[model samples]
Target: MSDYILGSHQPLAASYPLALVDLDGVAYKGHLPIEYAAESLVSARNSGLALVFVTNNASREPEDVAGQLTGLDIPTSPHEVMTAAQACARLLRSHVQPGAKVLVVGGAGLLTAVQAEGYTVVSSTDDEPDAVAQGFHPSLGWEHLAEGAYAVSRGAIHVASNLDLSLPTARGYAPGNGALVGAVQAATGVKPFSAGKPSPAMYDMALEKAGVSSALVVGDRLDTDLAGARAGGYHGLHVLTGVNSARDDILALPQERPHFIARDLRGLLETQPEVTRENEWFICNDARVRILDGALNIDSAGEPDELDIVRASCNAVWSFVDEGGEFDNTSIPHFSTL
Candidate 1:
């Protein structure tokens, strides 16, 4: 909340009543569990901090998502999960009546959600559907996207789960739901309303489902997870376990910067030290960083080399950029946390 990393004397796991955790990056990447994710989450739950696994991936249902985490040794219930598919359906209710015909442009997860919300699902635009709810699924073909485009062109209100441009896979990054949604937009020349991260749709649902006033949004994507937190008026904790790196975070846009940065979920169980500005150097414990003659330099490599260096560097760089300081992007070195 302070312009950069905020210190917590108490373990972050017990600091807030609820945590709206991002699934892919924070808990697990794809189907594999991140290091210490299960243990740290279990500890937080045991300590009475409730958690809701929120995700922009609308391909899977909450039950499936919960099952995936439970198999990873992170014991979870379906009620503890929230997906963008569910959020998309909720968003539809505001624009159309319950039982209104809707075109679902994704897979079973989205179809099931739209139906559960009492909307009649239609596959084609000829059904004269009232709205189109679009999400991502791997089996999607050119035909599906064309259908969404046509439906929207006919004045069906278009809504998508999220605008994420890419999806992560074992083989590397692949096309995400947003990429497909872009095709529909290009065809219709009308942008779809996004109901995923950076829009606060899922976060709003998570808050109501958890019945909490404030929450900590944790994730690896700055554009979606962290940006959503800022938009929803909640604190964000950026974890360097997926998608984004420490340097990516150090130079994050002001609107997407996180309140806390950590190596992993273990940060939830650890105290974060203060990053202070003293003269030209930004200090975090023994770590210090400053820009000298337009060259960013680490004056000191603090204890826990990687963490402290990142913390110090973020404060120094963010402060510099915000104060109208300019430097070449390459001048900022990337500190590897892996």
Candidate 2:
């Protein structure tokens, strides 16, 4: 891993004409916006960067997601949004015959999006459809999977909105769309054509909608957002606001780590001279964390106290900076002293 920080004259400038940020884990989780997320979006917009909420969560339609963002004081328009569900719908419409019968195994949002694209949605009670599409939504279950499998087995095209197995939540991570697709695949012995992150389909759709070559993909997860950006030939900005933490670097890192790492949206938006050297920075939910000598060090606590957390944090930081270091929680001593 290269430890060098970006410089001002780097060929790839940080200034982007548009930014595509993930919704659930990047901008907001549930009802609350991640700390500094709304402000960052606002700042990006003020800087003349077009903002779009690109999400793999297919539970909500673009308008619904945009409405939620507007409620959170983040300015967004319906056209300035893209969802995996919408992309899947578009793909089905473009490739399949117009008004083709389609079976949907997902939420109301997915059904609504497909219907809007002029496809006849076939339910379990209805006739077997020409195509079966799966989108990630909380309400999907075995019945939907069975229907999707049956449809695919009967020669319907299997379309998946995304292949992410887990989605970040406040409690931790939960089964995502990929789980449902796995079930369908197992039952029917058919693999789905994915239309979301880690696949360039959705990113291509977003690029066409945004109409810009200079773009940045900002998200918390490495596998989905960052991987998608890399595959689609765009810069990725990793924000430590939701699912990803410093501890996840050891095993969960994607083939390509993000071009830039920020503690949160605020850290990303803060104007600083380009990094002249490799620097380590301490990141905490609190603003007191400081950046020192291209590495993060904590100085707030007294020497007699908070040793364990500090050490663990230090180890995590070092793991990121040092390519060969192993992060074995059991190997590190004095873990409880902090």
Per-candidate TM vs. native?
0.96, 0.77
Candidate 2, lDDT over the whole model: 0.70
* Candidate 1 lDDT tens digits, 1-338: 28687888888887899999998878987887799999999998999889999999998988999999999999999999999999999899889999899999998888989999999999898999889999999998899999888889999999898889998765668889999999999999998988999988788888887888888899999999999998988889998888988878877998898888888998888888888888898888888878877667877443547677778777777887888988557876555544
Give the number of colliding residue pairs in candidate 2: 7
lDDT digits (tens) for residues 1-338 of candidate 2? 23222222322224677788888778888677787888878876886777778888887877888899999989788888889988888878655886999998988778988998899998963596889889988877778788788889989998888888988776778898998799889988888888888776777777787777768788888788877887887777767777765444323454445655566776446542232212443332321222344344454554422322332344344455455544444432332421
Worst 10 residues of 2 by lDDT: 4-13
Q: lDDT for each of the candidates?
A: 0.87, 0.70
Model 1 residue 214 distance off true place after TM-score fit, in angstroms: 1.1
